[model samples]
Target: MKLTSYWLDTVPRFTGTPQAALPGQADAVIVGGGFSGLSAALRLRQLGASVVVLERDRVIGEASGRNGGHVNNGLAGSFTDACAKLGEDTATRLYKVLNSAVDTVETITRENGIDCDFTRCGKLKVGNRQAHEAALQTDYARLTVAADPEACLLDETQVREELGSDLFSSGLLYPKSARMHMGRFGIGLANAVLHAGGLIFENTPMTGMKRTGNSFEMTTPQGKILAKSVLMATGISRNAPAWFRQRIMPVGSFIVATEPMDEAAMRRIMPGGRNVVTMQNIHNYFRATADHRLIFGGRASFSRSRTTTDITSGNMLLAAMRRTLPELPDVKIDYCWGGDVDMTVDRLPHAGQWNGVFYTMGYSGHGTQMSVYMGQRMAEAMAGMPDTNPLAGRAWQKIPCYGLASHFLPLVGAFYRAKDFVQEMKE
Candidate 1:
């Protein structure tokens, strides 16, 4: 099995335009060449702003390409709990924003004619424990009444039909949730930005950024760019800016892909071809690729290294998958990879500026859709329409003791694992 991202390995990397060269100045400068940065750059170009995107490595090769290929809409937490925490009106607004993100992704793919196999295949959220059955039911009831009209709670009969495993007691389905080849989408989005007259520079990491009299000066390893506006789309990488270090915690998420499954096994396992996610604090998410390969991933390890620790987590995922589907006992594993997710204390995405830089991040494992939509919204905000962004004025609190590194991650993981074990024992 190749220890790499199936998405990044499969798609052509976007290395900017022909004869890609760094430019000196632009109307707007964006750091991080992932979906968020490229999408924002595309929108900025549409608004006739001269834009440039800077990437530290291969475009979208980080968490963007390393994700589980889910464009699933909704919040990280349950809608009912979200309403209680964020208030009814605010939570509802946030829910709609996530829904709008799905639309934005579809619109970009359609309008730009990105052939990334974008499909509205829906999402299947299942309960890991008996308690989660009631949890899904409660969430579904609240959802159907207000947020998602198409969401429905699945009983045991329906659950058995949807999932091969009888371990789950109940499930919830969101029809609006979609899936896509994220690597292709990233390349397509980057190309769209270039076609719209934006410059992208890969392998260029921003070393320093400072506001200098009505413009921002961004210094990179290769060259520097002076811009009237700056967008900090860079996530939890090693070179994260000093100011952003305190606000975001870098968490490790891992994935492993199984070799192509037989047609019979594929049909029997995930017949509906939906993104399947476990309803656990430390959850497992799996889906079938168009090529009939199974991509299963989760927060298997707290360590963020791409090697050793990543391989260890991949083995854990393989064991988990085998336990879930004994039918795939002999299936050969083909790929494995890891990426860093920007998690916030509140588990909600934050946008708006700190100092003079406009930014958006902290998706907390729910980024694909929100990142795409918020990029356009931030573009509109930069164009003098702050009302377009619902998360614009949201407060961003720094994680306590998360200044640069998460030293207590091991303790945190242990606590959650123990809690989950207790819940399982109770059931």
Candidate 2:
């Protein structure tokens, strides 16, 4: 499919130094150039390690550039669900790690002088139904207890006032959360990595990787990179190593960008221009861009291809938006696009070593913040300091379904969609 207008025309351009050819060898080699790989490279370079990054496309070409730009806190699942799956102590540690992750991204952007339009406007996880309200309340309590003192719950009226939409029954405002220009952010990080003396090779896809003795050899179309260690940060690309592909399923999610609107129009939808996501199983996340466009995103599909001119997904998202704000029915959609999200069976991100090669992906929709944190953690882990690592000895052990996610994702998606439909009907 041809790239959509949103992706083709709307994303910010990078004026950084041009990418260089793949290096012959490095101290550390990264397979992907999205948030995880670039962040990892930056941190590794800061630690005085020589690094090389291989990107299949130009930087910010896929999910990292195409998401809804919500720098959300915590994992994708509810805090209660996380605690249930990982236990209270483990889940609490994970939550703290992720909360700090959000701040880490902001700090990196600021310290490096990256102009990514990052704003700490907070995030609202809104409830769409009575049942959802109960879940939201429980989540609010759990998150408040797990969160810092600044986090608080917003009642229905407060949610309405904050979001300027009555569609939500309640909201849990994560004060530490923020929004960003994802595409620009990706470019900024790439530039930062380059400025720090790390090498990035654009349009260089990894064809194969093999573990040899104590090091890994990564083969690309143009050349091969041999390094002491390799990090796989390919979020949803099917071209990943076989062992890596088995653990994560790449589900496609679409997003639509409305024509630029005035501040009054934007405020009518998202008061304070804070990012908002509904509390549904198949949730919808939206945020106003720095350009005042309503970037509404949701609606998952199993299709592997997307058309630039096709507005079907965009129309569907607009209809969903109008269901909450009847005043915006005629809002013109300027761009529509889709990207793959790496989802795991347990709905938690996977970050660990596989086959002597370190890797991190499958954040679901929580990549914006968690990706940065995982990258930093992965760097620290590679530096021979596992005991003090944040992700060490956690409940993030490999799940049984990790090996089946890629093969059974369609069935899994259908089941989840059915669950979402039933829940939406109950609303």
Candidate 3:
């Protein structure tokens, strides 16, 4: 199996602006060329601002292209807990923001004519335990009245109709969830930035940046540039400014894709044709590609993604997939890869201006749609428009003892695994 992202391999590699020179000055300079940066660049240009994007690697080579391909709506964690912690009104508003995020992604793809197979296939959050089934019921009832009226709870019989596996007892369905060809969308977004008079410099890393009067001077190996405004769209970046780095934790998320199976077989495995996420502490999320490849992903380990770590995590995921879906005994695994998630302590996205720099990140794992939506909002705010940022004014604290956090991930992983085991045993 190739240790590379299947999404990135299937689409054309992004070749940035033809012969575009690094300008000495721009109205806005975006750090990181992932979904957030690219979306911001596109909107910035539309607002008549000269924008420049600096990417440490190839465009979309990071978490943007290395995901489970679910443009799902709703909160990343327990909606009931979010309501308690953030207040019901705040939680409802944020949940609607996510619904709007999906709309934003669809709108962008349609307006740009990006043929990325965008589809509103919805999502199913399945539970394996009876306790989990009860929790799903409670959450579904709360959401239908408080935030999402479109959500529905699936009984065990309904769950069996949707999922082929006998593991799931019930599920909660969110009809607004969608999926897309991430690679195609990323490359298309980059091309849109170029066509919109924005400049994208691939393989360019912003090594340093400091304020110069009202403008910010950013340094790179190739050259330096001055920008009146800057956006730190960098997610879990080791090279980011210290203040931003301390607040975000980079957690490893890994995935494996099976070779294209027969369409009939794929349909049998996922008759409902929806994105599936398990209700576990160390959860797994999966979906089938347009070509019938099963892309299954999860927190295989707490360690960061590396050459060796990816292979080990891929193997773990393969084993888990087999246990979950017994029909895949002879299927070949075509791709295995991993990426780091910008996880926050609260598991919510934070976006606003820091000091003088505009910033947005900490999506945890539910970012595919929010990243694009927030990017556009950040762009509008940068252009002197009213701040429609839903996450504005939310306090962002540094992770406790974050300096030594990576050393403790294994312990955290072990604890969660044990907790899952005990919970299962109780049933």
Candidate 4:
């Protein structure tokens, strides 16, 4: 099966737009055309800075388009783990920043009139097994202590009522979270950036970047751009500058979208069309698309190759979905695909200056909201304000093994997967 985004193909691409050429010089240069790069371009333009975005492929052509489209709250790691790694004070600040990112994405979609099917439907973190439920309880307690009191918990009955699936024993509800048509959201964000007077060059791959004086020079096949500051938002591309590859590891995550189910069948699976993520170590994240298809995603591989035609591995994913809702045992998968997520070792995103360049990436699977928020933070930082805003300063300290782990991910990822499997069996 060819990897096609149902959400992306349903919407029209940005047509009749003028192609942007590489400028001789710019105030800022942003690499990657996904949510992070485009959002950063828009914010920087809003701040009256001359910005240019160079993308290797068409905008949202990778993970940003290929994801499951569940835009939820917080990072991939638990609050407790984050507190342990980053200390209590910094971890609390980071949670608040990510909490605000959920709202920031909503605000941008509405204010820009982007028809990306943005919805504030709450997310349910469901737990299937007893150990999973126990972990959720711990997570709930930690989040409760660090988050707004309004974010509450749900028992088994409430979980089933909300999700219409008996697989979950308990749930944690984060009211501030949301879901959007991720492909369309990325496209709309690019359009918003262009409308805001920023330059976006699609199909322009940044080959190399060199620091010159206080600025950076970025080279592409067709042209080159010199800028005062650069933002390297390319998540998983190994072709990224050496400095970027040091702090980020690209981990492959797969997603399979089922054929549109009948309205009655859809109602039976998800009552309110809310997004749900499981508590398993190799977790499953899913949601109902606007077209009434279930977008189920999970299972990670360390490979970087783009081969979307393996139905055997997809069967495992479908089986996982069946565990969540037995009613969907026979649902045919319409599309199966996978993309790489830039993961940091500690599971917290890294954002700060590398040498003289300002950059942000490595959101794990939590990029949907955090990418946009980090863009705004980058813009603020470039505007001569350096207070280490909530998200920026919290995780600036790189994990000890982040650099080494990212470079040799193919070897280390197997160990991580083994650990997850062992943990699941113990449960």
The Cα local distance difference test for each model comes to 0.85, 0.77, 0.92, 0.77
Give the poorly placed runs of model 2, Cα more than 4 Å off: 1-8, 11-21, 300-310, 393-427
TM-score ranking, best first: 3, 1, 2, 4
- Cα distance off (Å), candidate 2, residue 95: 0.9
Better of 1 and 2 by lDDT: 1
> What TM-score does model 4 achieve against the real structure?
0.90
lDDT score at residue 199, model 3, on the 0-100 scale: 95
Tens digit of per-residue lDDT, candidate 2, span 1-427: 2236364355566543365666678999888888999999999999899998888887777778888888887667788888887788888888888888899999999989988789998887788678877877787777777754566677788887877676777777777789887876788898899899988888789898888888888898888888998888898777887666666667778888888898787877777567788876667888888888888888655443454324666666777888766656366777778877777667777777877788888887778888887888898777776553565443443446664555665576678779978877776
Which consecutive 10 residues in model 2 have the weakest lDDT in total? 1-10
RMSD of 2: 2.9
**What are the per-residue Cα lDDT tens digits for candidate 1 across 339-373?**
88898888888888878788888888899999888
- For residues 1-427, what per-residue lDDT tens digits would candidate 4 score against the true structure? 4356676676677541385556799999888888888888888888899988888878888778878887887656666677777788887877888788998999999989888889888777777677767777787788887765556678888887777777678788777778988877888888898889888887789988888888788899978889898888888778876656765666767788888888888888898577888876567888997778898888645554445334554676778788778776467888877777877766767788767777778788888898888888887787677774455544443446655664575566567668767875786
Best model per TM-score: 3
Predicted candidate 3 versus true structure: per-residue lDDT over 242-284, tens digit per residue = 9999999988899999999999888888889999999888899
Cα deviation of 130, candidate 3, in Å: 1.8
Candidate 2 backbone clash number: 0
